[model samples]
Target: MMTTIAAARSAGATRWTLTSLSLSMLLSSLGTSIANVGLPTLSEAFNAPFQSVQWVVIAYLLAITALIVSVGRLGDITGRRRLLLIGIGLFTLASALCAVAPTLNLLITARALQGLGAAIMMALTLAFVSDAVPKPRIGRAMGMLGTMSAIGTAMGPTLGGLLIYGFGWRAIFLITVPLGLLTGWLAYRWLPADSAKSGARRSGFDVPGTLMLVVMLTAYGLAMTIGRGSFGWLNSALLVFAGVALWMFVSIEKRVASPLIHLEMFRDPDLSACLAMSALVTMVMMATLVVGPFYLSEALELDAVGVGLVMSVGPLGAALTGVPAGRVVDRFGARRMTVSGLAAMVIGCFALSITPAEFGIGGYVVAVAVITSGYALFQTANNTAVMADVIADQRGVISGLLNLSRNLGLVSGAAALGAVFALASRSVGSNLAHPDAIAHGMQTTFAVALMLMGMALVIALRRLKAHGR
Candidate 1:
C-alpha cells in the first residue's frame, strides 16, 4: 500500500511538472506570435512609423537569440528551478509593463526584458523533461512541448485579434499576466528542487565566451534583419563583426575552465550531424512562410481571408501531429523516425515543386499539410534524440544550442530564401512581377527548397549509419 501510494503521488507530481513546463513553452511562443498582430495597432497608438514599431517584434527576437545559451548555462551553474521561477516572474512583470507603457521605446525595452525571461523559460523547459519524466517516455514529453508550441503559435493571432477587437491592444499583453502568474505558482509547487551536486560540478562560469557568443549572435541577427529584406553595407559590416566575434568566442571557449559549449562536442559526428540537419531542415521550412503568401496572393489571386485560412494549415497540421509523432518515435526509435520524417518532407517538397498552379489552394494545402506533418515528426524525433541521452549537467546548454540552430535557420530563411524567391520572380517590391512570373517563382523557390531538403535527407542517412542503424 505504501509503495503504491508513493508511486501514485510521484506520478501526480510528474503530471503537474509537465503542465508547468508546457505552459512555459506556450507563453514564450505566445509572446512572439501575439505581439506580431499588435504591430499595426502599436504604430497608431504611439504615432510611430512601421520601421520604429517593428522594433517591438525585433527586440524580443534579438534578446532571445543573444541570451538563450547564456541563460541556459546560468541555469546549469545556478539552479534551473530557481532561475525558471525568476524567469516566469520577470516575464509576468514585463508583460504588465508592456501593457502600460506610454511610449514605443518603453514598450520595446519591456519586450526585451520579456525576451530575457522567455530565453530562460525556453532553454530550461526542455532541460527539465529528463527530471520530470522517464527516459522511455522522452519522445512523448518532447512532443507535448512541441504541441504546446504549435498551439501557442496557432492561437496567438486569432486570440490577439479577438482581444484587440474587444478590448484594444493592451488586453493582449494584459492577458498573459494572469497566465504567467499561474505558471509561476505551478512551477514553484511542482518542479523538483535543484540538486546541489549538479551546481557543485561546475567550477566557474564562462563569462567571456558567453559575452562573445551574445555579440556574435546579436550581430548575425542584426545583419540578417536590419535591412528590411534588402542587404546593405551596414549588414555587411555586421556580418564582418559577427565573424570576428565567432573567432573570439572559440578562443575564449578553448581556454575557459567551464565552457558554455563543449568545444570537443563538435567532434562527435552525431552532434555535428544533428545540428546541421536541423538548421537545414528549418531553413527549408521557412520558405513556406516567406514565399507561400506571395504565391497565394499574386499568383492565385487569394483575398486576405483566403490567404490566411490556407496559410494556417501548416500550424494546424503541426499541432495535430506532434503527439502522434512523439508516440511513433517512442515505438520505432528516434533514428528511424528521423529519417522517415525527412523522407516525408522530401516527397512533400517534390510534390510542391511540380504542383500545378491551376489547382491553387487545394494543391498548396495538401503539399503544406504533408510538409508540416513531416516537420512535426522530424522536430519531435530530433529533439528527443538530442535530449534523451544528454547528461543532467549539460542539458540546459544543449537545449539552448538546439533552439539557437532553429532561430538561425529562421533568420537565414527569411533573408536568403526570401531573396531567392524575389530574385527568381523578378519582383522588385510588392507584386511588381506578373502573375505568371509569381507562379514560376513559387516553382523555383520550392525547387530550391526541395534541394535543401535533399541535403538534409543525406545528412540524416549518414547520421543513421554513424549510429549503426
Candidate 2:
C-alpha cells in the first residue's frame, strides 16, 4: 500500500511540475512585450514625459539583467524547485502591488520586483522541464517551451491593448496575479527536491563577487538609461561609475573561490561565437521594438492600438518559427540554421528601413511582419546554439548569460535608438503636422538596426563556414 501511494504521488508530481514550468515560461516571455501597448496610456496617466515613461519599461528589464546571473547561480546552489516557487510568490505579490500603485515611482519599483521573479522563472523553466521529461523527449520539450514563450511575447502588444481598452492598465497586471499564484502553488507541491545539478556542492556564497557584479550591471544600466539624455557623453560621473563598476566586477570575479561566472566557458570556440551572436541578435531585436512602434505612431499617425497590432507581427513570426527552427537545429546543427536566420533578418530590416510613411497602414503592417518573421527565425536558432553544447550542471549559468546578453542588448538598443530618434526629432523640430521629423528619426534608427544586422550576419556566416570545415 505504501509503495503504491508513493508511485502515484511521483506520477502526479511529474504531471504538475511540467505544467507549472510551462506556465512560468509563458509568463516570463509575456512580460517582455506586454507592457508595450500600455506605454502611451501609462505616460498619459502618470503625467510623465515620454523619456521618463520609457524608464518604466527600462527599469524592469534592467533589474532582470542585473539579477538573472546571480539568481541562476543561486538556484543551482539551492534547489531549482524551491527557488522557482519563491520567485513565483514574489512575482505574484509584486504584480498585485503594480496593479494598485498610486504613482509611477511605486509602479516602477514594483515592476522591478516583478522582474526579479521573472528572472527566476526564466532561468529554471528549461532545467525543470528536462528533469521532468525523459531524455528522448527533451528536444521536443524545449521546442514547445520556446514556441509558447514566443507566442506570449508576440501576443503581448495585442493582449495588452485589448486589456487596456477593456478594463484599463491596472487590469494588465491584475489578471496575471491569479495565474501566478496558481502556478506557484503547483510548483511548490509538485517540483522535486533534488533538482540541483548533480555533485554540485554548496560552497559558501561569494558575497563580495556577487555584490561587485550587481554594482557593475546596475551602473551599466544607469549609464545606458540616463547617460546620453541627462549627462551626455562627456559626463564625468557617468563615465566614472561605469568604468569603476566594470573594473571591479572583473577583478572580483577572477579572485572568487566559486566565481559567479565561470570564465573558462569561453574557451570553446562554438560557445564564444554563440554568446557573441546572442548578444548581437538581442541588440538588434530590442532596438527594433522601440523603432517599430515609434515609426507607426509618430510617422504614420497611427494610434497606440494600431501600433500594438502592427508591432505584434514580429512576435507572431517568432512563435511560428521556434519549433521548426529547433528541429532544424537538432538535425542540421546550429551553424546552418543561425546563418540562414541572420540572412532573413537582414532582408527584413532592410525592407522595413526603406518602407516610407506613404505606404499606408496596410503596407507598413506587411513590412513589420516580414521583419518580425526574420526575428523569430534568428532567435530560435541562436537559442538552440547556446543550449546545444552546454553541460547539464551549467545550463542555469548559460541560461543566465543568454538572458543577460539579451537584456544588455535591450538596454543598449533602448538607449541608443531612443537617443538617436530624439536627436533627429529635435533637429527636425516639434511640428506635429510635419511627420518628416519623426520620419527622419525613424529612418536613422532603422539604418542603425540595418548596420547591426550586417554585423550579426558576418558573425553567423563565419560560424557556419567554420563549422562546415
Candidate 3:
C-alpha cells in the first residue's frame, strides 16, 4: 500500500542520484588526467619552455587545493545541489575559454577557473551520494563512484591522443563541453532540489580564514613549483611565506565562528592517521604517473599514442578492481585492505626499480598495472574509512579535507619527484631526453616510491594497533 509506494520512490531516487553523480565524477576526473597528455603539445604550440607550460596543470591543482575547504563549507551552509549546478555551469564555461585561449597565460588562467568549479563539484559529490544511499550501501555507492573515476583516468590519455591526432590539443578541452552540458542537464533533472537537510541556517562565511588558507596553499604550491627549477632563493622566500600563512591560518581558525576547517577533527587519531596515509599513497601514485610517460617516450621510444595506450593499463587495472576493493572494505574492514594494498605497491615499485631498460613496453605495462591495482585498493578502502570516521553533519568538511589531502599529494609529487628525476638524470651525464638518463631517473623515482610505500605501510600498521583492528 502506502509503504510499497514509498519504497518504490526511494529506489527511483537512488538510481537517478547515482547516475547523475557518477557522470559528474567521470567528467571531473577526466579533466584531471586528460590535460596531462597535452602538456608537451601545448609547450610546442605556445613556444614556451616546458617549465612555463607545466603551469597549465599546476594552476588547476593549486586552485582546487586552495578553495576546496571553503567551498565545502559553503555547500553545507547553502545547499550542495545548488553549489553543484553552479560548479558544473562554471566548469563548462571555463572549458570553453580554455579551448579558444590564444596565449599560454590565458590558458593557464582558464584552467585555474576550471579548477575552482571542479573543487566545488568534487567537494559535494560524496556528500550528495551519501545523502541519497542508505548507510549500509555507502561502500557500494563509493565503489561505483570510484569506478567512474577510474574510467575517466583510464580513458583520458587514450582519448587525448586520439583527439590530438585527429584535431589538436584544443580538442581535448572542447570535448568536455558537450559532456559537461549533458552532465549538468541530467543533474538538474534528476538530482533532488533540496538534498541538504532543512533548518540548517546559513552562517557567516569565514572570509579571513578562507583568505589565509588560500595564501598558505598558494605559497606552498609556488614554493614547490619553484623548487623544481633553478630559482633557489625565490623558492626559499615562498617557503617562508607558506610558513607564515600556515601560522596565521591556525591562529585564525581557533577564533573564527564558522571556520573553514574544523581543527578539532584531527584530534581523532584515526582521522589524522588515515589522512596522512592517504596523502602518502597519493604522492607515490601520482609521482609514478608523472614520470611514466617520460619513461615510455624517452626510454622506450614510443610516440604519444603508444605512450597513451601503455599508460592506460594502470587506470584500466584500477577500473577493473575498484568495485571489488570497495566491497572488500565493507566486509573485511579498511585496515586489512589498506595494509595489503601498500604491500602490493611496495612490490610493484621494487619491480619497476629493478626492471631493465631493455624490457621496454611490456614490462612497463605490467608494472603500472600492478601499481595502480594497489592504488585502487588503497584509495577505495582509505576513502571509505575516512567518511566512516566523521559524523553525518561533518561529512561535507571531511570530504573537502580528504580531497585537499590528495591534491596536496598531487602538487608535491609533481614538484618533488620531478626534481628528483631531473637531478638523477643529470647525475647520469645525460638529460631526460637520453634513454640512459630516463632509465636512471625512473629507477631512482621508483626506489623513492618503494620507500614511501613502506612508510605508508608502517603508518597503517600503527593505525591498526591504535584502533585494535
- Candidate whose TM-score is highest: 1
Stretches of candidate 3 off by over 4 Å are 1-8, 40-52, 102-104, 193-200, 226-231, 431-434
Write down the TM-score for model 2. 0.86
Local accuracy by lDDT, each model: 0.90, 0.75, 0.84
The TM-score obtained by model 1 is 0.97
Q: In model 3, which range of ten residues has the least summed lDDT?
A: 195-204
Instruction: Name the top lDDT candidate.
Output: 1
lDDT of candidate 2 over 40-159, digit per residue (tens): 999999998877777667777777888888887777777777778889988899889989999999998998999999988888776565567654444445666777787888777778
lDDT of 3 at 467: 75
TM-score of each: 0.97, 0.86, 0.92
Cα lDDT, model 1, residue 385: 91
Put down candidate 3 lDDT per residue, 391-456, tens digits, no spaces: 655677788888889888877887777778778888987555999998999999889988888888
**Candidate 3 local lDDT, residue 131:** 74
In model 3, pairs of residues that clash are none
- Write out the backbone clash pairs for model 1: none
